[model samples]
Each structure stands twice: as structure tokens, then as C-alpha cells.
Target: MTRKAPDAQTLSLMLDNVKFDSNGLIAAIAQQHDTGEILMLAWMNHEALEETLQTGRVCYYSRSRQNLWRKGETSGQTQQLIEARLDCDGDAVLLLVDQTGVACHTGRKSCFYRSFTEDGLKEISKPEIDPGQLYARPHKH
Candidate 1:
């Protein structure tokens, strides 16, 4: 069955019931429903939470950058929110999305392409697009 878009009140009620982690941060998981692909995981603060709901865009709190960020803001591979759900504990979120393009900043459909085995971590698939072509060159390096 399809879920009609919930009103703000309902959304708020849903949020109120979830158990947020101690740090007031929740884990948000991005997935592509059509392909059953797990894209990436990020943290979400309350502001990021509100931003994502209001914009229908996936936003997360970047631990490294120490700011709220929308995925693919610079890369143009935005994840359009199809649906968002909180885990039973309310400490985690799952976002079903219609991905605009590659979900991984590394230019793959998913960021979880690396596999760890006895030989250690390995790249299992070639990037679907060249990240450098889609995003500006990194300044840190």
C-alpha cells in the first residue's frame, strides 16, 4: 500500500515517539528503493532533520565538516527523498530516495562498494562516473 504524505503534525508525532541517541544525533541510512541499493550512512541533528523534511532533500550533519550538509550539493548527484522512516528505537533513520545520479561521492551508485575479506578491503566495482568531472577538485589534497 502506498503511504500518503503525512501532515506536519503527524510527522512531528512520529518524531516525538522515536528514541534519539544520547548525543541528540540519529543515524540516517540512504537507500535506493527501486534497486534495493544501500547508498550511505550519515548522522542527522535536529536541524538537519527539519531541513530534510522541509526540502524533500536528504541532509545530514557532517561529522568531519562539523556542519549540516545536503548530499551532492556540489556534486549534483542529489538524493531526492521518496520517504523517510525512523527505526523502532528512533535512533536511526532510513531514507528511500530517487537518486539523481551516482550516490557515492567516489562516483559510484553506492558508497558501500568496498568489501572487506581476508585479503583486506578491496574495490569491487568501477566508479560509474568520474567524480572529478562532476565535482570540483578537492582543495585539501
Candidate 2:
């Protein structure tokens, strides 16, 4: 059986346990719920965290844009949250999710597709789809 997430009140209390950095952001790592594959790493502010908890959709704060970025907003690779866990030190979070499509901007399954080989760094995973195709439309959210 799938575990139930905390409700609003409980979630609000749980937020108290999260330790955001001095920049008011925390690292949020996404992983495949069933396969345990590390998908991506992003940052989240308190509002983004609350939105994720409320909506069950992974939301992150983009450092470059300096705003909230909902995953797959531009692309179609959405992530459905299965579980959200705070780290032992409360400085980071682990998001167990069901990723619908490629998680990387390069159209790969994960951002960590590169591997360190005996010779040097290697790019192993190939893009399943063109990023330009995935992000054809302009992003609003």
C-alpha cells in the first residue's frame, strides 16, 4: 500500500522541522519512487515546498530565474510526488516521485547521465528527445 502524506495542518507543522539555508532555500533531490533512480536536484524555498506538499507536484525554485519553477512546466516531463522526506539534519529533502518523462533538460532520463571512466569523463545516456522539441512552448509557470 502507498503511504499517505500529511494533511495541511500536519504538513504546516512538519515544515517547522525543515532547515532552510541562509538564502532561504533547501536542496530538493528527486528520485524514482519504485526504481530508486536519482532523477535530478533542485532547490526549493518555503513557498515552493508548501506548494509541492499541497499539490503533490514537484515544485522548485530556480536560481537563475529567481522564481518558482514547476517541473515539466515547459517540457512535458512531470513528476508526481509519492513521498517527501526531510534529511536527518533538515538541510535537504528527498522527493520520491513517479517521473512521467525525461527528467533532464538534455532530454535524458536523468541529469547524472555522465560517467567517470578510466580514461576520462564520458557521456553515456543519449537524449531520448530533442530539448528544443520538449520546450517548444514558452514557459509561464
Candidate 3:
């Protein structure tokens, strides 16, 4: 399904309500639209949030690279924004998306694959695809 961008006035209001941290970043959680499975957690700055709202494509800020990180720019795991919701405190955002390929850089469907169990940390899910095959060049997440 195609998602439309919000009108200018609506966009302005939405932007104003978001409470970015002192670093000008907000926590964004991406989840599968249909299955309710959380795909990943990332940080988004104003630019990244605006771009995602306007283009219906998920974009994030790379804390490590100090730049905007377009999802699946290197890998074929792009996320299409279906819906976005801000928490009551406005400090975080929930993004319902259509994920293509694996969401995790480790080639897993979701980033939350590991679980803290009685037997130490255990990986609950296995990689569906090899990480090497996901990117054309060497990449760091």
C-alpha cells in the first residue's frame, strides 16, 4: 500500500510536538506493519525524520558516522514507512514499516534476535541470509 506524505501544516505541527534530546536526536523504533514484529531501533534527527515523513522511506541518523543513514542504501533491506506514531512524551517514535529483506546488518530479520536467558545470552533466531551477501562493499553499522 502506498503511503502519502502529510500536508505542510500537519507536518509542521508534528515536528513541533517531537521532543528531541539535547543532542537533537529522537529514538525511532521500526516494526513490521502486519506482523507487529519489531525490526530495529535507530536514532533520527530532524532531517532524517522529515525525509522519512515526506518520502515514506525510513531514514535514520548514524550516531557513529554523524550523518543521515538511509536504510538499505548499501544493502537491499529498505523499509517503506506505513505509519508513524509519537509517544505521549514525544521523546520517541514508533514506525510501522514494510521491511524488505533482512532488517539487521547481521542478516537477521530483526535486530532483537538475542535474548538474555537463564543460560547467559542466547541467540533466539538464526540469520536468514549471509551478511556478506547483503552489501556490495564493506559496511559497518
Top lDDT hit:
3
Worst 10 residues of 2 by lDDT: 1-10
Model 3: clashing residue pairs?
A: none
User: Best candidate, TM-score-wise?
Assistant: 3
Q: Please give, for residues 5-33, the per-residue lDDT of candidate 2 as tens digits.
A: 57889988999999999999999999999
Per-residue lDDT over 34-135 for candidate 1, one digit per residue giving the tens place of the 0 to 100 score = 887898888898878877877787889988888988887787788878888877766889999888888887898888999999999999988999888878
User: How far in Å is the alpha carbon of 18 misplaced in model 1?
Assistant: 2.9
lDDT of 3 by residue, 1-141 (tens): 678899989998889999999999999999999999999999999999999999998999999999999998889689999999999999999999999989999999999999998999999999999988988674443
Give the winner by lDDT: 1 or 3. Answer: 3
Report the Cα RMSD per candidate.
Answer: 4.1, 1.9, 2.7
The true-versus-predicted C-alpha distance at residue 43 of model 1, in Å, is 1.1
TM-score of 1: 0.84
Instruction: Assess each prediction's global lDDT (C-alpha) against the native.
Output: 0.81, 0.92, 0.94
If candidate 3 were superposed on the true structure by all CA atoms, what would the RMSD be? Answer: 2.7
